[model samples]
Target: MTSTAINFNQVAYLLITGASRGIGQRMAIETSRKFKPGSIVVLLARSASGLESTRAEILECNPHINVVTSSVDLSNASKQLLEDIIDKSLSKTPVGSFELAAIIHNVGTIGNVERKAVDMSDRQEWEEYFATNLFTVGVLNSCFLQKFRECAKKLVVNVTSKACLVPFKSMGFYCAGKAAREMYFKVLADEENDLVVLNYSPGPVDTDMTVDIQGRSNAEEIRNYFKGLRETTTILTTHQTTEKFISILEAGRFSSGDHVDYYD
Candidate 1:
C-alpha cells in the first residue's frame, strides 16, 4: 500500500541507534521535524557525548521534541546492560507518550581489515566485531519487538552495506557480519508477520568511517578504491540520505526482508 503520511498519533515512540553522527543523526533530526510537537526519540550509541550531541541537534531544531539519550557499548556488551538501557528508556514513559515508531540499526564498524587472510584474522578481534556489528542488531531488535509488539506499527531498518554482497580484500569480518544480518532479518521478517523489516544500503556517504578506510590499509588498490568513491559525485551527503529515507518512509513503498540501496 502506497503510504505517504506522517501521522504522529499512529506511533508512540522512535528508537534510533547510532544516532550520534552521520546518517543516523540526520535521520533523528529530520524525523523530529516531521513528528508533531513533543514527540519522543530515544538515541542509542556508545558515546554518551555523542548521543548528547544528537539530542542537542534535535532540540536545536525542535526544542519541544522530547529526546532521550542512552549510551551502551555494543562491543563487549553485557546482556544486563542492554536490558537496563531498555528498561530505563521505556519503563517510565507515560502511556500514550509516543506507538513505537521505528528502530534503526545505523550503528556499524568498518573492521580493521588490513591486507590479511580471513583464517589469520585475530580471534579476539573477530569476536569484538561480531558482538557489536551482528549480535547487537539481534539483541536490540528482539528487545524492541518484545517491548512494543502491541503497538500499531514497528519498522526495523537495518543499515547494511555493499560489502554484504561484495567482500573487500581482507575485510572478512565486515562482509560476513553484514551477510549474516541480512539473512537473519530475512528470517525474522518471515517469522514475525506484524513487523516491518528493511535492510537499507545508504551508499557511499562521506562519513568519518569512510575516510578512515582510505588510511586503514596500505594497499594502493584499497586506498585508491575508497578515495575514488569519496571524491566522486556519487558520495551522498547525510542530508541527502535523510531525505531519501524520509521519502521511502513517507511513500510507504518499502517491503520487509528485502534490501534497498540508495543509488538504486
Candidate 2:
C-alpha cells in the first residue's frame, strides 16, 4: 500500500473488518498512522496471511500502534464471538489510555454475480449472505459500542455502495445487502446520540470484487461497464479512494448518518 499524508483524529482503538486486502488493508494502514501511540487496532478477516500483511503494514507506518488480527469468518460471526474478539483484542491496553474509539464495517461478499434476481431464490444461499453482510454487521457494531462505552467519542462507519441507492442488474443480493446494511447504520445513528455513524459509499473501486463483477456478472451491460472502466483506466485505485475516505473523517462536516460518497 502506498502511503498518503492524510492525518486523522487520534482514536484510542480502531477496528476494521475485511482488513485482509484491497480497501480494508489500505484503510487500516493509513488510519493507524494518526492514532495515538500505543493505541490498539483490531483487524478481522478470514485470511491469516492477508491479516498478517496488513498488521505488518500498520506497524511499518507506526511502530507504536498495536495491531491484533483475527481470522474469523463473518458468515459465522455471533454476538459472543464479536464481544470476545474485542475483549481479547484490547486486553493488553492500559486503562484510560485514550478517549476515542472507531470501527469500520467493511466486510461484504458479492454473492455469485452470475446469478440474476430470479436465480437468488435459494433460501439457504440467502441465509448465508445475510449472515455475513447484514447479521454480522449488526452484531459486531453492538459489541463494539458496549465494549468501548467508556470512550467519550465513538465513530461507526459502514462501507456502503451506490447499489444501496439504486438497483443494478445481476446485483440483487449485493444491492439488497448493501441497502439493508446502510439503513441499519442510519437507524443506529438516529437512536444513538453518543456516536457518530456514517454510511460511506467507496465508489467503483478496482478490487478483486470488481474483477468478479467484470468477469462473471449475469448482465452483459454490467460486465461491459466494468470492462470499459479498466479499458479507459477510470477505475479508482484503493489508495485514491481510501484517501478520500480518511479525508472525510478528518473534515467532520458531514452530519451523522449521512450517506457520503467518494464522488461527493
Candidate 3:
C-alpha cells in the first residue's frame, strides 16, 4: 500500500536494531500498538532467543501485527546479510511504495575498564566498543538511508546516551563512540534525502548495561556523580522513553538533524 493509505492506518514498516532487550525491545512493543495491524516490524539483534521472546511479546500485544526477527551481529554484519534483509523486506511488501517508516539504532556497548585515558590498557577493548556503537550504526544507516530515499515518509531514530554530551570520567571510550555515531548522523542530516533522521538521548534507564556499570570498580564515584546531578536529571523507564520517541516519530515534522532528550 502507498504511504498515504498506510499513514491513515499507522501501518509503518519499522526496522529496529538491538531489539533483543532494553530500549530496542521496548520500542518494538510500543510500535506494534502505535502502528497498524498489518504494519511490518523488522527487529535485528545478536540473540536469537531474545529476538524470539520480543517477537512473542509483540504478537501477544497485537496478534495481527507483522513481526520479523533477524539475529545478526551488527558489529561484523556481512554485506550479503544486509542485501538479503533488504531483498526479503521488499519481497514481503509491495514495491515502489514500501517506505521504511521508522528505524531505531539502539545497539551499543560499554567496556568494563575504568582506567584513565593514559593508563588504559588493552586497546582491543576500546576497539570493541567503537565497533558496536559507532561503526555498526553507520553501516546500518547507510543501508537504511538508501532504501528510505528510494521510498518516502521515512524516520530514523538513534538511541544515544547523555554521556555523549556530558562525558563520564572513566567511560571515555563509550562516550566517544556514541559521539561519533551522533556526528555521523549530524552530517547525514545535512545531505539531500527524503528521510528524517533524529538522534535521541534516552536518558539513563534500568538495564543490564547500567547494572554492569554499577558493579564496576568506579561504581561509587559514578553513583555519587549521578546522585549530585539527580535533581536536574530524571531516569526514564523503557516504556516512557519508547513512547516519547514514537510520538515524535508520528508527529511527522522531524527535521534532518535534531538532538532530542527523553528526560527533557
Candidate 4:
C-alpha cells in the first residue's frame, strides 16, 4: 500500500490493452503526458487501425513518448501466441532497460450472446466471456510479473465492472467473468508482494459498446436499464472518468487487492 515518490526521469513503460478506444485510449494518452519524456507505452488491441489512431493521439499529447502497437485477437489467441507477442515486444526495448511501471487490463466483454444461464445456447458465450475478461488478466499478469519482478514500482490496475458486485439478468456471463476477475486478483495479491494490484470498476461509462448494449439483450429489464443510462445521461464519458483512474494510478496508495469504483 505504501509508495514513495516515483522517479519519472527514469525510463519507464506502461502496457494497456483495449487501447484503441474508451478509457484505455484516454489512459494511454494521459499517462504518457505525465510520464518522463521519452517513456514507452505499449498499446494492445484487436484493431490495428484503432491502435494507430490511439498512438497518434498519445503522441500528439507527448511528442517524446514512445508508442508500440500490438494488434492481436485475444479471444482466440493461444497462450504461446500471447507469450510470443509479449516476448518480442519486451525484447524490442528490453524490460531490464526500463521500469515496468504499470499493466492495465482494460480489455473485457459482455459477450456477443446476451442471455441468462437458462437461455444460453450452451457454454459457448460463458466460455468466451471468461476467456477474454477473466482468463487474459491472469495470464498477462503472470507474464508481466515474470518479466519485471525487479521493478520496484510495478502496478497492476484491473479494469473491472461493478456488475461483479451486482447481478445483471441478461449479462450473466459478463457478471460472472468480472466477479471471477476480482477474486483472481485478490488471491494474486496475497501471493505476490512485488506489485500492487487494484481492482477498479469504471462504472458504466458511455462508449461505443454501451450504445450497442441497449437492445442486444432478450430481457426487457436489462435492455431498459442500459437504454435508460443513455437516455437519462446517467453515464460518464471515458474522458470524464479517466481523471479519477489516473489519480488512482499516480497516487500509488492503494493496498494490493483493493477494489475501488470511479467515484471512490
TM-score of each: 0.90, 0.95, 0.87, 0.91
Tell how far residue 129 is off in model 4, in angstroms. Answer: 2.4
Candidate 4: clashing residue pairs, number? 0
Query: Tens-digit lDDT track for model 4 on 1-264?
Result: 445223344567888999999889887887777776647788999999999999998888778767889998877777677677767766666566676477889998777536567876777766777778877778877887777777667777888888889987777777778888899899888787666788888888987777666758767877788788888988888877887776776675677878889878
Q: Kindly list the per-residue Cα lDDT of model 2 for residues 1-264, writing each as its tens digit.
A: 111122355647889999999999989998888887768999999999999999998898799878999999999877888898988887867435765688999999998787888878799999999999999889898888887787767889899999999999999999999999999999988888777887889999999999999999989999999999999999999999989998887777677888999999
Ranked by lDDT, the better of candidates 1 and 2 is 2
Q: Supply the TM-score for candidate 1.
A: 0.90
**Which candidate leads in TM-score?**
2
List candidate 2 segments past 4 Å from native: 1-11, 92-95
Taking all chains together, the TM-score of candidate 2 against the true structure is 0.95
Candidate 1 wrongly placed segments (more than 4 Å): 1-11, 94-97
TM-score of 3: 0.87
The model with the greatest lDDT is 2
lDDT of 3 by residue, 40-150 (tens): 888899999999999999899888867888889877886667767866865657644543467788888876636666666777876777777887677777776676565
What is the alpha-carbon lDDT for the whole of candidate 2? Answer: 0.87
**Clashes (N, CA, C under 3 Å) per candidate:** 5, 0, 1, 0
* Candidate lDDT values, in order: 0.77, 0.87, 0.73, 0.78
lDDT of 4 at 35: 70
By lDDT, rank the candidates, best first.
2, 4, 1, 3
Tens digits of lDDT, candidate 1, 19-72: 888888998888876666656788988788888988998888777767889877
